[model samples]
Target chain A: MIVGERKPLEEIIESLEGAEKVLVAGCGTCVAICMAGGEKEVGMLASELKMAAKLRDMKIEVSEATAQRQCDKEYLDTLKDDVKGKDVVISMACGIGVQYMALNYEPMRVVPAVNTDFLGANLDVGEWAEYCQSCGDCVLADTGGVCPIARCSKSLLNGPCGGSADGKCEIDPETECAWQLIYDRMKALGRLEKLTEIRPPRSWKTSRDGGPRRLVREDQKA
Target chain B: MKSGSNLEKVFEKGEFALTGECGPPRGADLEVVKEKAKHLVGYVDAVNVTDNQTSIVRMSSIGASKVLIDMGLEPVMQMVCRDRNRIAMQSDIFGAYALGIRNMLCLSGDHQIFGNQQDAKNVFDIDSIQLINVVHTMREEGKILGGDDIDGKPEMFIGAAANPFGDPFDFRPIRLAKKVAAGVDFIQTQCIYNMPKFREYMKRVVDMGLHEKCHIMAGITPLKSLPMAKYMAKKVSGIDVPQEILDRMKGVEKKKRAAEGIKLAIEQIQEVKDIEGVDGVHLMAIEWEKKVPEIVEGAGLHPRPQVS
Candidate 1:
């Protein structure tokens, strides 16, 4: 689950000021669970946009439609027909959804309705927070479930730095020290001695540094 | 001689007025809104354009009001603070007033979590009370939201929604009093089906002496079908159609339910109007505008006084 927040309505309306036929598109996957981009949200944005347009004395035609998963081509193909006639497509999906629509519908102007923040899960209903950076590395097995890449201000792989203050990080007093959490978890597992092992420098080239990444499954392909 | 101030005169005089509600189109089709406008213009004193009613996005209330204005109808543009903060909402008030929309209905709007676009963020810069106060601030204090003085202020006839049918009934009058205290000139309540409950609620307002301060309009929407009645009873918050009304609607065939709804609505209007406390009635036909005149006439309300 990825957690994110919505942008202000005025900012979004400003983007679509010149557009007459606006399509408020949404995604029903992660964004739906997070209460960000879903059918209900798309309908609301469409209505708000219409209200704003009315005040401006401009005739804005707002249409609402939601896809299953905006990051997938199959889901985006569903909107192939509607996308052509729209002057602007306000995507309420995550950044992936917004870019996916752009990749497929090259002609239509795609705008992000939600500011995609991080890959995290809901703390509870109507609340969400970041948890993962998707660095393409799985060190959770060595460090308990906490991801230092996201929890630690500095993505230190081996152990906590000198800045750990009373089990909390110095930069963010509100955040628990990721190293402290890791050390506690390792101690519980009788692996506290693992901290003494020095770690090699990180190789970030395997992640987004390489460029857009892909995963191929020859067995699943037709 | 000025029409705008002349319109204000009637409202300030405590005269009874009629208002109707219209939801804008979901798509860019103007014809659909125009068709609804056809049934509203000239029949009612003004039409209330919903701003994202039920938190579902559709065409803008402002655009729909313009269409209503083009059709020679006065419009009360509904403004909800759900999507906008203080800056935008204040600016919109001035902008709408400048564009000739003089009436407004302030609301906190539905939470975004309930709408079709669930991922949409919410900016609750202010609640309904603050919004009403802002309008009053502009009208009385003659200043912008930022406290900058203006030579002239925006004069808006503001209204708010009341829920008589909501449970823990004690809170209703208190909420109404709060809105009144915030400078709300009038109030349009949620749907009123059970006159006894509404009458009982009004007694509280009378006890508080609020009846003399604000013009109260009873909201009435005819139950088009048994399913619609059931839906309203179960799904729609702040609305409760009595079992008797549902039973009355249940016996009717589906084809004739619309006519039955109009008759039932007329009956409601007749009951609510005869009550001494209710100043007027706000009819929310809900995509049934054509039946408004029928309901109005059925209730024996003439557009103007008859010659002796």
Candidate 2:
């Protein structure tokens, strides 16, 4: 799922500056499951924003609403009534949500409350770790399920750079070296030879570096 | 024309090349760079100008490279992929060339988290290898990245960094081979304190015949004191200081440790030059740029051969 974290209160407050009618919008999908931008979080942020506005003696109106998923135009249209006459809409969803809301509502200001981190998985209660780089070119079959692009600090296709010690990355000891994990997993699978050969430098044409990517399905599209 | 820099001439002359590193100051102070360049002027073939090394936000490396050029010293401009995107990188390439900087060293810079501005968004749009390919294409094909033709091509002597001490030891040389295949004309490896491991790496490099493909300059960073040695051993990545070297550093008098450090560096230089596949020695004195002359002199590489 897409993982995100709340922006700092100071930055959020500053982003809301000069706004009279502010809407704190939320997404009820991936962000909600990750505990980042659900209805509850939107309510909490709405209260804080109102309290902050009152303390500053600013004549501001902050409203709260959550869509089934702010990424879709249909869901974004559900808030058109409440969003009317708002000075700014503070989105509590991923970057897609913020853009979708901005597209649906032409001139009203739209601000993001969360910084989209990465494609990640929940490790434990309230714990999330990035699992993919969305490179579009997947090589998980060769490395025994380890995602080097996401996990390795340098993202070297060749494996760990000599700084791996005791299976931990040299930069961050708390993080496991992706190459080390690849080696151990490959060894257990009796496929150590797969890693011996030099893996070529990754081609970027299919990755995000090449350009802004899109999926065009002619068969499914109208 | 083949590389016009004196450093390239030294390599072309087939005599062992000796390069020194001079870091730019954090501000617009050109005096520090001039002072450092003056110390390295007659001793080394070329000087490498680091680009915001360690992400501390220094004066641009291209600006410092120009300073070196003004001092009658050749420069190898180090460009890290941590800061600029492709557009900015290509623009800088054209700018640096227009400014008369010749050599270029491609690097995947230190993560921004290690620097003072941890909050700064990193722009790793292209890795070092990709950066090399981009620069190589710009020079050779006379076209910008995305295959667009440019008004003129900027010729440069391409270089890249190699960390032989890092993990999955066998992959180090393979990575070097990849750099060679990617059009790296020269390679400046990570600093060498563990001669045995470096020797092993060089053997692999020679076996793969990478030395014949490109110039391999062994990196030699002098430790100023015991704390520096300890810090390198602990914090610096891809570095392994043998216990004996650390012990030697510990045995020195606090004040004399600087001299001892230079001595150790001299010994390493002499030893690394003897390695079969090694083509040159890159002396990185960090902030102790003044000590570079002594290291070059002690290593018996004084009055560096006039390659012009």
DockQ of each: 0.02, 0.29
Candidate 1 regions with alpha-carbon error over 4 angstroms: A1-222, B1-14, B304-308
TM-score of each: 0.58, 0.81
Stretches of candidate 2 exceeding 4 Å from the true structure: A6-28, A37-115, A133-145, A152-171, A177-218, B137-153
Q: Give fnat, all candidates.
A: 0.00, 0.27
Locate the minimum summed-lDDT window of 10 residues in model 2 chain B: B166-175
A3-120 per-residue lDDT for model 2 (tens digits)? 9998987899888878888889999998998888999999889888888878989788888899989999999899988899899999999999999899889987999999999999
* Best candidate according to TM-score: 2
lDDT of 1 by residue, B177-278 (tens): 777877787788889887788999999998999888777889999877888899887666556677888888988898999899899888888888777668
**Mind sharing the TM-score for model 1?**
0.58
The digit string of per-residue lDDT tens for model 2 on B157-179 reads 99999988876676677678777
Listed for every candidate in order, the interface RMSD values in angstroms are 24.2, 3.5
Instruction: Summarize candidate 1's per-residue lDDT along A1-222 as a digit string, tens digits.
Output: 765567799889888867889889989998887888888888888888888778878878888889999999998999877787889999999998999998899878888889888888777866666678787866787787778767765565645533454566644557677877887787779875564444433445456655877888998995
Assess each prediction's global lDDT (C-alpha) against the native: 0.76, 0.87
